[model samples]
Target chain A: MKFMSNKTLKMSKVLLSAVLSVGIIASLSGCGSNESAKNSATPPADSAGSNLIVSQTNPIVIDKEAKTVKVYTEVNGKYFVEPTRHGVVFKDGSNGSKSVLKAWGNQNDFYNGLVDIGAKPGNNLKLDSVGVAVEGDPLDVSITWAGAGKEIPFGDGILDSTKKGFDFRFGGNQENAKAKNTGCILCLDSCPVGITSNAAHPTKDFDNKIAEFKGNQEVLPADGTPVVVTFKLK
Target chain B: MNTKQRKWLNVLGSGLLGFNFGFVAALLLAQWTWLELRVNTGLAILVGVGIGLGIGLLRTIKRPLAVESISLLAMLISLLGIGDAQISSLKILTGYTIREGLLMPDISLQVANLIFSLLTLGSILSAIVLKRKISG
Candidate 1:
């Protein structure tokens, strides 16, 4: 390195910095400010008499005819909160880093959407500081992804996560709750609309830090791809 | 070159190098998920110090204080850049609301960014303090 003059070193450093800056700027360009609030989402004008229950501001549609609740979502990436685990999280929630799908809708609205389709709200799981499922009844619900030609159960897209699909419970309304967002739309751990475990069998309890549950990369699309998630009663 | 000219050159060069190195590290921390999630805080700090040491070892130094001062300034700028990039990356991936995301970041991301920025400063400081042995 001493053989090279100071001028050469400066030039090289400049080139390297420029290269890195461009790459990061490109990635940054892909992202836009979150304006979901400013532009309220409205349902299609054609569906006046149809059995479609749509949110005025959120991207949730309750289909009473199909006996299902549909939510708009995008792939968060194969590696979210954990190495292998890929859970579903609310778009407005803080746990997007740990979830595979980012659902763009209100959690409360999702809950009501389920109710509209005759799905009963089950007891929500409560966890200790260590994140163990101490209490809560599992709701009778089934989650699926039909973005592909055929309908695929949520368990199929996941790898080594669970045996009994996804055991979910309606984590009741949190209208006045002081948490980041009221009502849990869908989570891996204990919440009103969360699943039993993000991991299949943890050494101790259901912790989000564990990298046990992985998304099957072959089955799922790449990150940032938009898709629909459906919820139905068992 | 005169002594004064040499000193100024050394200071400016070190500061620029430090800023670029820190920016590169931030980009890596933002893009790579494994590094961000798996690497612990202590290890991250060590890595930062190591980068600083490497920068110091590369240069021929006479006046260390001037270089150190500039390096510190560079560290601050790098810290801001890293924080903004990390937040923007999270917002894009998660679609978080402006209130909860840009303004109020997740505790986990905050911890991660803090560690990364610390590493940037460590590298800059180490580089300035590290002396290249004069080869006869």
Candidate 2:
């Protein structure tokens, strides 16, 4: 009996140390991941979407002061997401934002997976930072969003095999990305259907849309003609 | 130490941890989904019990637990907490857009709930329970 007990105790100690050592190593490795996989992403030498000064073309967008959804994320496979009852909250002084998944029915799993993927909260994404932009709402209310995946299918639930997509114009406004020119596109080639809003208060698009952009290309503007932008905000 | 005593310590400490984590996860999920019930309470209890028992198997443990064991638990809790917080936030933000009756980009809350409860937290919590049992 004594031998068994002593053996168990010794073995447990060794295993415990191994467990802790492994964790420390993992966290340390993550800190340096920001080292970047490629040369600093050159802002599209004119890849600027709107505001010219700041672009919302990237997967994630941030307003910094507003604590709201400038633009969110959508993976290709994810089908549905829940709505954010609280809306978005932003961390102050952040230069970037992560693409957010819409919190649908399975929020817990979605969230945990993200953290595993290194989604920074309180620093990058603050859930409790309820939209100060929206008044009379709970400050801590965490807003959940639904995820959209399949490419922009055409009306009647079929893929738009045509090159007709919307030519998006930037509200050109930097104050708040309120979508303007949401109507009337001069061209619609290889574009989806219409102008619609995405994670950003206004992910300019041709109407008849749903927010989905995983395993897909960046949403180009419609009309094949550059959507002239004019940054105007409140 | 007697095997029975080691077993009890492992089981009880791990059990408490499992219960506490489940409760916290539920709260966090609720916050993310903006729904009253992110994880069904009854279902959560069942999960918690199963986890507790599994950990209890590691119940024959060392005393006082160790630094490494505790650190691992902390890491898991921190990670899960952060994830839950994000999901809750997304739900709230998307709610407003949809309320305005606009179809927008959003991730599914149900999926988040499952991942958090069954996979992430569930795995770590179970692991910790066992760790504590063995350490004791």
Candidate 3:
């Protein structure tokens, strides 16, 4: 009886150890995956019976007549851990802690979609300290949630908790110092796309130092809830 | 060194192991369900801590300190690994944008790796020291 119990205890401990080892190894092996591969494989969700040009591999619908572009997105990030600072952006472009919605669509596609609707892109944003000039098209962004059953304006879904806010402008992403554009679409910080209200908002790769914006949990749906984001030329 | 101290150590380690596992499980579950199940950060944390504390207070196992610490460490590493994998997969599928002329670096992964590294080191050192003390 004593030998049986000891053997069982030893076996259980070994099993626990194995579980721990395998779980960690599996997690670490996930680091090398590339999103670009998956992006090319999956087709965009269909938008039939609508006057919208939805692409084959991208998650956007462009309406030339309506002069608007819509991108499928989801409620992302949170108010507690990382304040929601971005209105809308490519999933990889914005910091997870600060972004509100990580869009499924490509940033370059969204920019082109806006252009298809006749929104001219121009260089109006000037970051004096960084000596970087930014080009942006004024955009009227809004969210339509399936859960809420209503369209919420940009200001309604996102809030400047400090009460200091600005209008969002589509700052089409710029090429890096290496002359490669990574398709960064829109940002709260004054990047290629930025808040027109804060001309002084510094450009950053991920972490935005001026993080005053956050999602209005009461108005916004739960995280990961599917939604449509509309961008109209202002 | 005494029986009471050893007993409490086992409880603490068990509780920590439970909390770590619970927290990681909650994160994975939230991702798997896409949060439609309403698994938020608060709920995950609350459930984890509650379960951990419960196991700590209620469990009667009197494991050696070295065994307890090593087990806790192993669980932490595994949980951290799974968290890393989930974050990476999410990034690969959804987060593939460029910033400053390059792919956006995995900041969360880097931070998580650093935290787990420190924890693993601490666990190793404690296990060795505790084993030596018990033997001596």
Candidate 3, residues A1-234, lDDT tens digits: the string is: 979856655664565466446545644554333223322332233243474433333468877766778777655533312343356656544333235666677666676687688876654544332434344666777677543555567667766644545556655433331133333445555564432222334444123334456567667654455567777787
B-chain TM-score of model 2:
0.39
Candidate 3: clashing pairs of residues: A171-A192, A171-A193, A182-B98
Candidate 1: segments with Cα more than 4 A from true spot = A1-58, A78-86, A96-98, A127-147, A161-165, A173-178, A182-184, A191-211, B1-136
Query: lDDT per residue, candidate 1, A125-165, as tens digits?
Result: 33323443323333433333323554466666666544434
Tell me, by TM-score, which candidate is best: 1
| TM-score of only chain B in every candidate structure | 0.31, 0.39, 0.46
Model 2 per-residue lDDT at B6: 55
Best by DockQ: 2
- Which digits, one per residue and each the tens of the lDDT, describe model 2 over residues A1-234? 979866755654675566445434443443233223212322221222433221223323222233322222222111112222111111111100111122111222222222332333212112132211111111111111111122232121112323232222211121121122111111111111111111221222212233222111123210011111111111
What lDDT tens digits, residue by residue, belong to model 3 across residues B12-101? Answer: 545555544544454444343223112233244346546755776676444334344445544445445643545433332211111100
- Which ten contiguous residues of candidate 3 chain A have the minimum total lDDT? A34-43
- lDDT per residue (tens digit) for residues B1-136 in model 2: 5767656656655554555455444434433332321222223433554586586675443443342245335534644454354433333222222221111223232222232233333334444555555545
